[model samples]
Target: MIPIYKPYMPQNIGVEISEILYSGQLGFGKYGREFENKLQSFIGAEYVLSVSSYNIAMLIVLSTLGLREGDEVIASPVSCLASNQPFAVKGLRVVWVDVNPATGAMCPDDLKSKITKNTKAIFHNHFCGYLGDIESINAICNSFGIPVVDDGIEAFGSQYKGRKLGNLGTDVTVFSFQTVRLPNTIDGGAIVFKDKDLYEKALLIRDYGIDRTIFRSSNGEINPDCDIEVEGYAGLMSELNSYIGTRQMDDINSLLAVQKNNAAIWNDKFTNLDTINSLKITAGCIPNYWVYGTLCKNKTKTIKDFKEQGYYATGVHINNNIYSVFNNNVSLKGVNEFINHFVAVPCGWWFENK
Candidate 1:
């Protein structure tokens, strides 16, 4: 059966892992630093921090925002719970924003209508590697003195206009390297910061607010005079994951190319199918097409038909506001429309017509 998603693992990954195991230093060390540097260079970001998972990456970014209880954070309702769960855990109120009907990304007009004095940040998800109108959203947020956090987990290799997703001038951008995502590290993620101060703070926060590098003396000897200034967490990526990630980076471009090619194939085939509507890409935005989603007249029937034909198709993520934990029953017209009809089929590099 064709799965909806499959990770791209390189041929030399086992050898890389063996090296990490034999080195006897397996925590956040040289491999992690190397991976961070490579990712920074790849995405053209000023600073990148490797974290254990995408969820932890989001938590770290939200924690650095200096939000207080009852502070509001604007976010799209049509995203995986991971995108908005950080806000709730940080004691920030979630102000739900609708998504674009065509792209399934945060709608800038809806975002504008939701911003208030209490809005501390605006979190936008680049759904299925398709970028939203982030520039316009950033403009509105900037006017209100609010920062934007991009949940770019599914958009690692995507570009909007000419700029990459992570370096699109957002305040903070987080990406995932989970088992099913592109350039999988088994389980890891990264955070990119536009602000140097926040990047430095994140460096400390990933390792319990303690600067481990400061403990090394000029001669590379251990110095026990370091201090811990702020509260932090054990969010650092492991050396094994980083090593795998570094190798995966070598094939990222090719992997994205194949996925995009497969999505184009589906787009062309479904163009004349009156019962299906493919998700539209915005002008000048080149999507990596993590999963090719379609709005079908009968989503349930379409999913069953696809499954029977050896293709695994399903909803990418449930709308966050539908859960009782969020208790948000407000009408998000676009989101409601999307959730009711959307279904995603396999468009990963491993996918093939059977």
Candidate 2:
């Protein structure tokens, strides 16, 4: 049976990994810097930082935001837990922004209605790698002088308008390189910053808040003068993960092309099916097509039928509000509609070989 998601590993990765394992420089070093540089070039962003995973990437972005307890953040209810859980863990209140059932993305109108003086930032999640109305979301947040944090975990290679998601005027964009994502590095992530100051701050805070530029004297001895300005977490990516990421970057373009081509085929096949309605793609955006999502009248029946035909299918993401940890009870009309019918099927590069 074909599965809905698959991790792509380069055939030559064993040789590359063995080389790094034997080099004795297993920590963040040349390869980590190289991976960050590659990401900067690909995303057309001025500042990029490689981290251990997407969860750590979000924490690093939150560190730069300077948000206090109880500050409200506008975010979609329909997204992976990795996208919104960081806010709750940071003691910030998450104000749910309803999604457009047609697209499975945040509804700009709902966002406009929810903003208030308590709103510190807006977290824009690109659902299933399908682009959202970020232009409108940016315009709304800009009026209030709020920053926008793009949760690009599933949108690593997606292009919005003419630029990539990270470089599209958002204040911060975080990407996931975890297994099953387009460019898997075993498990890793990256952050792209629009502000140079924030980028510098992240550099210091990513590894115990020590200033690497002057932490050691000219003779390689620890400087007694170095002071820890801000306490930080251990979030930097390791040299091993970085080496794998650099290798994966080599084939990113072709990997993306195959997913797009497969999605187009699925789109055509389901177009005339009266029981199935495909999700909509935003205008001027080329999605990475992490999975081919569709809405049906009976999600359970559809999934079972696919399984019987030797294909895996199911609801990929559940609305975060349903969990008790969030403690949210607001009823959202669009979210209700989306949760009822949304289901995903296999649409990765692996299908090409099958």
For all predicted structures, in order, the TM-scores are 0.94, 0.97
Error of 2 at 146 (Å): 0.4
Runs of candidate 1 with Cα error greater than 4 angstroms are 215-225
Clashes of 2: 0
lDDT of 1 at 100: 77
Instruction: Compose the digit string of candidate 1's lDDT tens values, residues 132-187.
Output: 88889899999999999888888898998888888889999999898988878999
TM-score winner among the candidates? 2
Q: Which candidate tops lDDT? A: 2
lDDT of 1 at 56: 85
lDDT of each: 0.85, 0.88
CA displacement after TM-score superposition, residue 87 of candidate 1 (Å):
1.9
